[model samples]
Target: DVKVTQSSRYLVKRTGEKVFLECVQDMDHENMFWYRQDPGLGLRLIYFSYDVKMKEKGDIPEGYSVSREKKERFSLILESASTNQTSMYLCASSFPLPGLAASSYNEQFFGPGTRLTVL
Candidate 1:
């Protein structure tokens, strides 16, 4: 089965500190994404990478960045953690559109996210 594993289940950081959250997938998928899930805001995309070393900024990229150096790994970086940035960060991976089987492309699978709390 396809699997996405995040480096941390929870994290605590001081305000203005740098933070990194890592994710790895073993399925050799073609797409990966990072999103912050807030109580009323739902999941807001932060960044996404379609191929190794190639990335695209999502809707809410301010104060955050990403890296995808290896086909199986993706990372999210918070330049300066702030109390307002505290939220559940999720990582997802999926196959290319018109995926493995033309009609088999399904919903994105989510990782047990990293809940980040900035003090």
Candidate 2:
């Protein structure tokens, strides 16, 4: 089975402090995603990468950044953590299907999740 693991299950930080969240996947998937999940807001993408050394900003990348130097690992960076950033952070990776790609965008298998609290 494919597996994704986060560096932390919970985190606490003060406002303005820098924070880093790491994720690693065992599957040799081509896509990795960083998302913040909030109540009512569902899951909003923060960043994603399809290949090593390449990344794409997602819907909410203003307070975040990401890195993908290796196929199995992805990192999320918060230059200055804030209270608003406190939420459930999830990491996912997927392997795309070639034919009928639209229907097979690779279901995201998420990590256990990191609950970050920035006070």
Worst 10 residues of 2 by lDDT: 96-105
Q: Give Cα-based local distance difference scores for all models.
A: 0.91, 0.91
Off by over 4 Å in 1: 98-105
- Which stretches in model 2 have alpha-carbon errors above 4 Å? 98-104
Best by lDDT: 2
Give candidate 2's whole-model lDDT: 0.91
Q: Where does candidate 1 have its weakest 10-residue lDDT segment? A: 98-107
- Residue-level lDDT of model 1, residues 18-113, one tens digit each, is 999999999998789999999878899999888899898989999999999999999999998999999999999987775435423656878999
The per-residue C-alpha lDDT of model 2 at residue 62 equals 99
Clashes of each: 0, 0
